[model samples]
Target: MTTVSVPSQSRLLNRELSSVEFYARVLELAEDDGLPLLERVKFAAIFAQFLDEFFMIRVAGLLELDEADLGVRSADGLTPAQALGAIRERIGQLLTRQAKLWKRGLRPALSDAGLDVATLEECSDKEREKLAKYFEREIFPILTPLAVGPGQPFPYVSGLSMSLGVIASDPASDEERFARVKVPEGLDRFVPVGKRLVPLEAVISHFLPMLFTGMEITERALFRVTRDADFEVSDDADDLLEAVESELRRRRFGDVVRLELSSSASQAMHARLVDGLGVKANQVYEVEGLLDQADLSQLVAHHRPELKHEQWAPVVPPRWARVKTAGGVFDEIRRGDLLVHQPYQSYRASFEAFAQAASRDPDVIAIKTTVYRTSDESALVSSLIECAEEGKQSVCLVELKARFDERRNIEWSRAMEQAGVHVVHGFPDLKIHAKMTLVVRREADGLRRYVHIGTGNYNASTARLYEDMGLFTADEEIAADVADLFNYVTGFGRPQQFRKLLVAPFTMRDRLVEEIRRVADAAAEGRHARIRLKLNALVDPTVIDELYAASAAGVPIEIQARSICMLRPGVKKLSETIRVTSIVGRFLEHSRVYWFESGDESCVFLGSADLMPRNLDRRIE
Candidate 1:
């Protein structure tokens, strides 16, 4: 056996901080000089969008815990307040780096490429006159100004919406009042004026005088609000769709979690805005550039495709391509389990086409699938609807609790129901995050089941961006397990046991723990022991502890986690035998693969479950 160094501490890393670190790594990609100019801008936009979600969900949750006096401690042992403080500090640093990258790197590169984000002062007379006429004719009609005074109430600020806060004084009487002008979300963030582009906020600020005709604009500043958009549905809720709709309606009025303002804002202006919103001083952020850097997506979307990374179309995997020659889709899968890696391989040509064929096949009688998140152009849904119209039985477990996707799922569920597909809105409390599809077909011998399991959503658009894998198998045991799993989800009937697959909220955690201990037992017996895992996150304390124990027993462990790793490796006497690496690249690493070896026995399993507690014990994945 080989010797492995052990870390001194027996503790997990902070999950919140680990998540922040992941975003920082993305920002590092944005800062990479080797990347194409526009590709770097895209990374910056992704980083900003990631941070927005972090605040809206993670940070807001922590604040809520602190306020509720729950004294919740993370798997890494940080109190809610401690975690919040650390998050704010790290976020401040990242915000500075993001601002610097835009100001010093992308902005200059863009200008050099003749795609400048110019200001009002930078525009020439002709451009300025054109913009003035454009603004008056197009933007002015939709503008609504709300005032704050003795009689007027403070206007409601919607979450993530950009706005201009103004302090205007009556020219003759010197009477000052505060008001707000919301930047329409529908308009482009950057308006083009001839060769240059202008920030929407800058245009609105320059024309603030026009909006407040007789008032002297004393102070004007760009600002944005981030609110707690996370909500829960009671397990006993009678109607899941209505519950989600109600929460969506209430999301806009959620407590303000973050307030971002321009760095140039006067102290008086900042203080007034802060007080009016009832946000604490710690929640305020003064940004040096655009209020919402996510809008940089517009800059990335510029038509300068030459400055961006070369686009590559996906190729159909040869195995899938050979299906026609082999007889049919069923014959191809029956030959052996077929695997296709996404982005590098086209999902539409393979997995989606499989469903389409299944729907049309005369032999196929029943189709059952789990729907988490899919796009409007989803051929899977279309196929399922078509199957129903053809008098074939079809069932779709559309998870309405898939965060940020509840509305679309609801709409799809209703549409599927109208088309005669039995649509089951998933459990009220347990979200079904699994990616699965089963098709039962009639054959000369008997009824045969074909199943497709994947590590990503059924969304065709994301399939082009996310690195994932899908398996087409006709194995009897796995097929039976999938059938039972679908039955459990749709009929509230749980299986007594699984033959090959490790399921979540039941046996996944325990089985994983058992496998780790098996490796440790093998190591203790003076045999080779090893484990490998790749996942989007690793935060379950129980699983981490088992890995720590396995490390102490001299088992070699390697993890390639894309985000939120709580286990701290490389420390003495704790986790030295373990190694962790995160990959941030053009395609998102979203698949989860696990491998374990001990003595003569070895096993490999792939599924949708992450090592996170929510995935293991709470969700129905």
Candidate 2:
């Protein structure tokens, strides 16, 4: 018998292209007429924000790649520059589809539904008069018209900020001039003016003559700039927070990677804006209809409940519903293990209640947790503050490098520190991505540690929009493992072996691979074997190779990924037993669950780390 080997490149898909495909799915939701009107609008706004982050980080990284690295190719064999070109081409198609949807589908449908994003030309005479008065009194005072002159340099257009590029001509001197007027961030992007929602930019554009009073405002082009927002802090930095703060400051002046403009802009104005920004020609994206999809969020916020998805109220998990004692929640967890699913089960009743209970419990001597991401109104932050105030030791491992959430995490970390909690921003390079809480209580027996671990961030707002699972347990071995993990993060103590739990950057990847191989062995023996995975991404080459091998050995694999799956399923021989699907809908499928069966019993993992190299190798899951 002859054996054939499939090349590694043939088994994988480009990760960057895979991500753009995810957004394409999101855009499809906006085109879904079966969806509630405002729900469609919400998806549209989300898609725009997704693209913003994609360019800010992913494309920005590609643009900044050094000459040597740019030549290196990805798993599917496209070099960095080639990937950027592919991303650009795909983005162009997405934007075209998005624009068509907005103009032919959403906008018209919204108008018929009485929730329209209107133009000044669409306003009635009486409504126009009122809006004009409103603009002058409300928006005009906030506007500042900056022009390029002998002493004045071109204005710095902040990233993602919508600004008007003016081609103003001086009538007296016959001199052609250029100026920029920044749309006020403080004002609403859209304003309600009698029966419709008006984009604030139109109002600003309507009154641009007022800002550049005497000069002839020849052309008013609306455009947005997306600059490089990705940053890194040195591991050697003594003060990680200070280092991050410095990087953030430097991030503001990062080279502009993308320029978005109205499709109707004049040629001269377009060239002038592009030249002033020093952005490459290929980087500019001319948008039709609304220039910024994010600005449509104001329209989605309108009081039209009938046009949106039915509101969901997370229910209290039956276990915590009847608890009345100050620390009764912890006692209930000890009674039996508790599992709460977010957006279905109440986050407030589960995690928030746990933190509150720990703060109130005189028995709880200490509270330790990791903060990869959280909300401004984070219950854990307040709970930790309260616990610290009550003389309980409160230690928080705040990850200050959670991508776009860095600034907010920094703010939360500083707040925790001020409240006397031991706030430890994890290492600059090695991010602490695990989401778990360790509560030490002075019980009658001795020191009992209660653990709350989850497959999502400890954020209240996202809890309602993201699907996640969290476990509240007093299981001795798991509790001990979590405690050890916390110690390893804050101080130093790496256990040689973990009895039950799998801690990442150490045990997770190897353990998961071992489970896969075990199941493959069972399948090869003609026994029952299967693998099921639900995650945000799966790009780790090592794990992917193992999966392919398992599938070849007759093990059945089912993968449901939300974004960026490198694994190409349904291959004739290499992965005949593997299946892949992506689920994107009202709720973001944020939880990660990897279940493997050998014969009868199954091994399952639930955590924050995705099957990606960086998550497995650098992050502490």
Candidate 3:
């Protein structure tokens, strides 16, 4: 057998396509009948929602790159236009499988299980009357029909908002009008009629005539528009927060990257949408079944718990669980370093309980933490607020740049500020993404710092659904490093260096590469060398090159990348010693863990950062 090393770029895979493949993995779960019904339904919804975001951000950016002729290329060397073509082709194929999963599989299964998702045609006359009354009372007041004619410009289609393209004609005036009706976002995607659920768009389409008063509906089709929602704040903007909010306001009208139409859409309606939305034919997608299969989430829940996965309550390890209740979370950490594998272990018992105890502990002097994506009623945030109310010094580094979470973070920042907690919005140019907390407590010997570092957000809601890692340690070196990290984020100067932690945009990438090279050296020396990485994405070209170097040196490397893996593993000598796997299941795998070994010594690091260039070089993690 002959072995050859492929160039780094040659070994790279298209990031966008890899991301779609991740969604396809989710769809596989949805298509598999062995899983619980609602769990499969959940995956189906997640698959659609994932693709929606992929288009809104990734595909939209590519389309813009193509339009601007910037010649932007991905790690795999595909130009923007070329990537768009590949994406369109891939999504078209995925959509077919997705539609079949719903119409041919889940829909029938749900009907057999005594839950029906009925179309307008399937509704009985009595059911129709009931829905009509319900619509008039609950939905009619919010409906707005915009007519397009000589003076009427096509109504602005907001991104991801479902709507109806209506063709209505006035018999008396012989006037045919093209109109659009936006489905109310506040209402459920599927309305209840007896035991059956009806698509909201279908119901809206059924009553288009009443909305137009004198006009008769000739044809109607459900449609959705996805627009570019990605924006960057000016580094030197007078007010970064204001700039971000302004950009969010403008995001609604961003260039339409995709226009999805129901298969029932007439050629005339489709043509009108494409023109009005300024979307190209390649960007228009005709959906065979529901325009937004993500809405299936609303239709899938059943009264029978058997239809859903068996509820599993997170539990603390018996070792820590007893110690936590007996002495405290601090006592448990003081025993040694502790790891909380979330969902498997209760976030409430570990992270939340830790914060709550710190806030209430009279011996605790000060507390500092980072907030990226937290809930409105987060126990963690509330604990900080309580700590502040108790006149304890508390600081919060809230990253206002967390995508899709800017508004919520902004609101939380303001509330924390009002509560007298020292709130920092972090840098305008760099988002502080490290999930860490520092608690300074009065120990008998001296002031000892306790720290908690995690691979997921501090959001309690997601903790139950996202598989993450949290480490509680009283290690002085690591605690000092965390304190320095907070100082860098909140105060003037960065630490010359971190003693134990790998902070990003400064030392994380360099340290990671150095560690990888050390493993490669060990392999060359005929010593044991190995590496294991688990992250949401692995696309940094430099890091991939390093891994390739290590693999060629015979260093065994295994990676569990949940999405967007660029490195092509098991490729002859180029990556013969490296293996990559993506695990997609009931829970989202979001933790980032990196391990390296040389001879007998092993180094392990877990953090909020992934191996992507943005995370390692641009963001502050």
Candidate 4:
């Protein structure tokens, strides 16, 4: 077993200071005048989304640790209990920044942009009458009001779902009452109030009297709950698919980790919710604006082109265009290997075109690919269905547990099956993270295999928005390895060694470790050595320690991680030679590129794997 050495306690920074200070710095940057106005709003939205996920996954995970009676200490020497306490304190401060942005920043800027988010008090009498009529016609029918009292139990609050809390008094008994009304998911999070936008919660609050009829309505507030959404599968399961299905079913019932309430919630109402949800007082958060700002993404799509960034269509490489124009897409592949950089270069011209060609070609024997994500109107999926309908073999290994994409993958798998395509739900315990496609063609000479290896998903929609790399090769060895990988995903045929491919859950992690060691050895021998890694995240402690060791040995390291990097850069002696920078722009930086320099021998590898424990050790290739 390869084990990474844990650094001494003295090396760890103060947990509260490290996490809280970084959050404060992010808030400072968000409020900085140097950034563009719209970009500042974007940053605020990004921070809110980030915090939402943190509550959903990280906070939930820590709560699970507490539930399991796990006493493991984090790298920073904080126990689960201590970590939760620290997170609550830090998150509270972060929420304060978010509230300030909404009140002091976004509201003013939005007003300047001629878009006003009106509160109930800000509405005219005619506008209020219009809202009341709209609420009665559309919203009243969808709401389910649940009373909490001696006869009624506390209602179950679904994860991230918003609700209106009503405080009413029974006209007969003069007893104080509490009732919860869940805002219908079908309704838009923000409804148009005349020319401006008003959050659905605010709209619902205005019509609370309609729901609780004959009761003296005293007060009303909005609240939401966020539960643990992470799915875990048992390793010893006899049937992987069954285990995954079961876990997916249970994900809805996970413990609540966060309860977001209106800042003006009464003390009685807060206490009742905290007890009802079985959540700690510290897990509760108070916000002045909308509970879930993720819905703001809808507002961002105003069709007002001038308010948004300029759209840039991905360019089609000359070679690809020539193939498409010449009516011979395969000729381009036959000539030589083609490399594509997505967003900058078109993915449909290459990957989607290959699938379409396979579907139309009579001599094509089989088409196989692993799908992690796809759009609703996926051209690649349509082509695969066409292949099946044309009496050609079409195999798809669909990962059903591709976070937040499970439902879509399930639907796609069913559609593929109905189309006579071989649909394989991947192993329950291990997610197949490889992005590959294989096509077998019967040619005049013999059989030929064309393969595509990408550093991102096959989803054309994401391809246009995510920075990724894809390689189209007719190389026999690479094609054979891809065949092996596909077979391994669809069946039980595991290849022990791969030619020109490093597969995770087998050799990828070991290969990375060995490469780092080689660089370290070269540095020790007075030879030039360096490593550059660009990834979306870096959380696996083994990789982090390896980079730390490399840094200690004087090997320069540059890392570009978009989110959740565990390694602390610029630490004296510990990581002095390591530099890290993250870039967030129009395109999501999704490609993972690893480059090493050992005495002028430069090597580069791109793949779909991140340096995370699940990707490295648990997920299948």
- Pick by TM-score: 1 or 4, better one: 1
Q: lDDT score of model 1?
A: 0.89
- Clash pairs (backbone) in predicted model 1: 6-572, 6-573, 7-571, 7-572, 7-573, 7-574, 8-572
Candidate 4: stretches off by over 4 Å: 1-6, 10-43, 236-243, 325-327
> Superposing every Cα of model 3 onto the true structure, what RMSD results?
2.0
Candidates sorted by lDDT, descending order? 2, 1, 3, 4
Better of 2 and 4 by TM-score: 2
Candidate 1, residues 1-621, lDDT tens digits: the string is: 233343423487888899999999999999998999988888998998998899899989988898998766776678888988998999999999988998899888889988888899999999999889888987888889999999899999999999999999997999999899999999998999998989988888888778999888988988999999899998899998899999999988999999999999999999889999999998998999867878888888777879887887999988777766312888888889988899899999888888898788888899899899999988999999999999999999999988889888889999999999999987887899899999998999999999999889999989999999899999999899899998888785656698877888889999998998999999989898899999999989788878888888888999999988989887777787999999989999999999999998998888899999899988876
lDDT of each: 0.89, 0.89, 0.88, 0.80
Off by over 4 Å in 3: 1-9, 300-302, 324-327
Candidate 1 versus the native: TM-score?
Answer: 0.97
Q: Candidate 3 residues 1-621, lDDT tens each?
A: 123456546789998899999988999999999998888888899899999999889988888789899767776788888888888898899899988888899988988887788898999999999999988998899999999999899998888999999888988998898889999899988888998889888888887767988777898888999889888888887776787788888887788988999998889999999988888999999999877878777756556788998888998777566753423778778989889999999998888888998888888889999999998657889999999999899999988888889888888888889999999877778988989999998888999889999999999889889999999999999999998888888889846688998988999999999999999899989999999999999999889889988988899999999988999999886888999999988889999999999999999999999999899878888
Cα lDDT tens digits, model 2, 18-132, are: 9999999999999999999989999999899999999998898887773357466788887888888999999999999999999999999999998777889988998889998
Q: TM-scores across all candidates?
A: 0.97, 0.97, 0.97, 0.93
